[model samples]
Target: MKQVLSGAITMLAGHPVAPSTVYRLLAKAGWRKIVPRPSHPKRSGWSRRLKSSPRR
Candidate 1:
């Protein structure tokens, strides 16, 4: 998010913006941080295998 925000700010303002500035702007815009749910590596293939297996 910081990288994307920095790039956008640089393009719009002709300068690099810091991560804190990005967070501040987002907060002002009523945006909050979101953490993605944890994923299990072993479960990755389970759904594919179940779908491809014979319906016995």
Candidate 2:
């Protein structure tokens, strides 16, 4: 948030939307949290571990 706000502030003073604010607004709008996929999960051994791991 601070980063975004800072960027906005740098670009235009007065009221500025910070990066954090954008995330907050998205959350309010029911946006899901983004999770990056594990890198090459299909080709990694970690994928097998994930499949074998018991659910919590």
Candidate 3:
């Protein structure tokens, strides 16, 4: 996000933008940090097991 914003600022304003400034601006815009979660173990194997299991 910071890199993209920095590039955009550099392109538009002819100056680099600080990461802290980008984060601060996003915070003011009500954006929150997101953490990605790994897929659930059972769900991951469901399709594989279904394919390998004997057909009814």
Candidate 4:
């Protein structure tokens, strides 16, 4: 859940299931707070350290 909400990508992009389907599942499972996080407030400019590196 944290990975999905980390701003790297949308839930649908990370998960094989559709975004709406995941959302509905979460809702039905009482996982309301498991949604994506909004854009960061203070972070400005792309930081090299924030980028995800290719896994070996």
- What residue runs in model 3 are displaced by over 4 Å at the alpha carbon? 36-56
Clashing pairs in 3: none
lDDT scores in order: 0.81, 0.68, 0.77, 0.56
- lDDT by residue (1-56, candidate 4, tens digit) is 73364333354467455556656756777875646556666665565345655556
CA displacement after TM-score superposition, residue 10 of candidate 4 (Å): 15
Worst 10 residues of 3 by lDDT: 36-45
Residues 1-56, model 3: lDDT tens digits: 67887688668877777778778888898999888766555675778688789998
Colliding pairs, model 4: none
Q: What is the lDDT of candidate 3?
A: 0.77
Q: Write the per-residue lDDT of candidate 2 for residues 6-42, one digit (tens) a residue.
A: 6765577557665666677667878776698866656
**Where's the lowest-lDDT run of ten residues in candidate 4?**
2-11
Candidate 2: residue pairs that collide:
1-20, 4-18, 4-19, 5-18
Estimated TM-score per prediction? 0.52, 0.33, 0.48, 0.31
Q: Rank the candidates by TM-score, best first.
A: 1, 3, 2, 4
- Of 2 and 3, which scores higher on lDDT? 3
TM-score of 3: 0.48
List candidate 1 stretches off by more than 4 Å. Answer: 35-56
Total residue pair clashes for candidate 4:
0
Count of clashing residue pairs in every prediction:
0, 4, 0, 0
Best-matching candidate per lDDT: 1
